[model samples]
Target: MRILHTADWHIGRRLHGFDLTKEQNHAFEQIEQIALDEHVDGIIMAGDLYDRSMPSEAAVAQLNQMLQQLNLVDKVPLYAISGNHDSAIRLSTGTPWFKSTQFYMYTRLEQAFKPVELPDTQLFLLPYFEPFAAQQYFNDDSLQHLEQAIVPIVAKMKTLFDPNKKHLLVAHFFVAGSATTDSETQLKVGGLAAVPAGLLKDFDYVALGHLHGKNALHAKNARYSGSPLKFSLSETKQEKGVFIVDTEPFKITFKPLTPLKNVQQLTEYFETLEDKDFYKDLQLDNYFGITLKDRKPIPNVMARLREIYPNIIALNRADGYETNVEGSGESGKQIRQKDPIELLSDFYKQVAKDDLSPQQIKWAQEALKIAAKRESK
Candidate 1:
């Protein structure tokens, strides 16, 4: 059976507070197009179908629309599991109905492990689970580690799994070989946090998720399809794609997907406002995170950049001597002559939003004063 392996859709996810619904929709369209073009028998989404456990109504609508399009327009079966970001119950709401449509979703560990038999292969779906959840599923208090908890589950699954047939396993977990970035949230860590790759050796091919970077993990028969979009500036250089797995002979190929908006980080040193062309050189069509090195504070720098690059997401000024102070042997330290509390109040006034509550402002002021005193010592 030919299958497309993709994961970490993160539908309804926002980047730098900017909504990514449009980008997500565009991506799903590409996925459907790929399915049609490839004539794949099935599409397997490893996990993280939504950005949050309690997804927004708009998120739900978008996901439903995409699922319907994939099923109705493409006429392909989609097997999916809930990741750490999803609420198991929410994703599994229409399990019975979805199964009829050949769009299977597994949310709970108890509901997982059972092989969903297709015409060409038997797929073992393992949804995202915490240690506590695994413990509850097995009804065993002795299950202390995630590896240990999964051992019994896999052992039980192996009995049901027909070794004679082509078997595929879908899972969402943090394996050792995968890479992680600041943008991706880490799973809960405890004694029951990890499940080793060795446990899945019985399966023909294992499609994994949880890490965002493509080619982050290495296994002879296992791989991560990676996220469809770049989630962070650190991932700007990554080639985002999905994996195409052929189960009959057991071969895997990567199919690249286009990203709606590229993310780029730029650093520049500025001595005067005339360095405007430096900002213009960057691709404004993509989101830009910029760091400016200036000897002194430039008035309305962000406003000026906004004129050329409207999609600038973040800005930081390097505080080194060259940027903040020119030709000064001693580090320029502006002495605060005002009362500590008043100085803190002014600092809060500069950074706090207009909608900040009075209590919040008061607390911030006090916290800043305490912090400053600690630093002085």
Candidate 2:
């Protein structure tokens, strides 16, 4: 069977303050086109269908439209699982409806034993789960680590797995030896979260998620279909795409997805940025993280840059400029002058090394308000 492996859709994700709805929709279209062109029998999405537990209406609608095109229109079987970022209970809705169609979605731990049987293959879907949940489900107190927690689940699947046929494991976890980026949240499950690749080496193919790079893990048959779009400035060099695997002959090929806008970095003064001819040849539609070498901020800098490069996502001062802000020198009490929300946001940026998403900021603001009210009382 010819199958396409993809993961980490993060459908509702935003880059800093920039909404990525249009870019996300474009990427979905490309996936649909790939499915149609490849004529794959099935598509396996490892996990993380959405960027957050509670997605916006527009994000939900985008997913609905894409699923309609892939499952109903193209008529390819889709098997997906919920990842760490997903709310398992919420994603479990419409289970009966999904099973009736070519869609198979798994969110709970018990779903691992039952494989999705195909013509000559068996697919085991394992969604993201906490170590405590796994321990309770199995009633095994000895399950102190992630690998130990998964051991019993894999043992159960082994009994049902047909060695005569091709077997694939679609799961979301941090496998040992996988390269990690800042975009990933460290799952502090028992403080031991990495699972050895050797445990999954028996499967014909292992389609994984939770790691953002395609080659995050180095197992023989395991690979990550990295996030379709770049999520962080740290991932600027990643080649985003999906993996195509042929089961019969056991061959795998990677097909890169055309990004809506490439992510690049430019460090120069305002004069260098004004060299329109230089950047025009480099494609203005690409997203950029600009660094200003000038001593002071330029007036209407973003406005002027947008006229040439319309997709700038981030900008900051280069070296030798310290304003006691988040990225500036860390020895000043300038943050005390800001409001509670701003101070909290700056602190978060300092720790996380990335700006908080709009949703996170909103939640932080509400929490700060509650704290302030309590103090007033």
Candidate 3:
């Protein structure tokens, strides 16, 4: 049986304050088309259906439309589980009717025990769970960490595995030795935790989530299908796609997807960036993190660059030039040349390491004016 493996849709995700709804919708279209074209038997969504636990109304609508088209209309069985980013309670609300539509969604750990048995494969879909949940479920207080909690669970799953059919484990936890990017929220951020890859040798294939790159893990049975779109500038080089796994023939195929607007990084000087020839072949709509090699600061640099590259996410200096700020960057003489608001803005940027919002600047201006009036009195 051939099935499509995918994870980390992050439907409501944004990049540097920009809404990604359009790009996400475009990705959903491609995924739907791919599923129909491949004529796969099943679609495996490991975890992270949305970017946040409380997704927007629009996000909900967007996901519902795509899911209806695939699961209800197309008649492909969808096996999914909730990740760290999803609200399991919300997802499980109307799940009673899901089975009729061939939608098997595993939100709680209790649902994971019963494997979704296909003709040629048995899928064990496990959602993201805390150590405390496992601790209580098994009545084992010794389950302190993620790995410690999962080992016993997997042992129980091994007992339920069918002898005739191939086994596939779908999960959303950090595995040991898996390479991670900034886009993924590290499951082990608290401490030494990741489930050891060697512990999962029983499965024919391990469809993973949480990591946005397909090449994150190096285990023989495991693979991260990765995010459908580039969520971070760090993921510029990552080939975003879905993985197709065949049970009988025992094959894995990666089919790439083209993002509507991809994340990218570029480094160039002031004059080079402005040249039309330099950017002629480049995708202007792609999100960019740029570094300028100019030694001296250019006036209204971001404004000038934005006219050509509309989606520049970040701008930095190659030499780490810190101008219009206090102490290290600018002399007191240069600081004195600036207006009160300019000085306050620069000082705020230096101290806070962020730009002053317009509302904040307005409040500061009023405070400065009040100070001036008091001085006159």
User: Which structure among the candidates has the greatest lDDT?
Assistant: 3
Q: In candidate 2, what residue range of length 10 has the lowest lDDT sum?
A: 183-192
Winner on lDDT (1 vs 3)? 3
Q: Which residue ranges in model 1 land beyond 4 Å of their true spot?
A: 184-192, 271-282, 318-377
Model 1, total clashes: 4
Candidate 1 accuracy as lDDT: 0.78
Name the runs in model 3 displaced over 4 angstroms: 185-192, 322-330, 333-377
What is the Cα-based lDDT of residue 246 in candidate 1?
A: 90
Sorted on lDDT, best first, the list reads 3, 2, 1
User: In angstroms, how far off is 143's CA in candidate 3?
Assistant: 0.5
lDDT tens per residue, model 2, 1-377: 99999999988998877888988888888887888899899899899998889988898898888877888888889999999888898888787698777799999988887899987999999999888888888898888878889888888888898877899999998888887766554432424488888888779999998787797776779998888998888788899889899988999999889888877888888788888766767877788988889765355678887887787888788776546553355555655666777777676666666788999989988888898899999
List the pairs of residues colliding in candidate 1. Answer: 145-192, 146-192, 294-323, 295-323
Question: Which candidate ranks first by TM-score, i.e. highest?
Answer: 3
Task: Give a tens-digit lDDT track for model 3, residues 271-358.
Answer: 9989999999999988999999986656678888999999999999889864543344667697688799988877677656789999
Position 65, candidate 1: lDDT: 88
Tell me the alpha-carbon RMSD of every candidate. Answer: 6.5, 9.5, 5.5
Residue 120's lDDT within candidate 3 is 74
lDDT score for candidate 2 against the true structure: 0.84
- The residue ranges of model 2 lying beyond 4 angstroms of the native Cα positions read 185-192, 294-300, 322-377
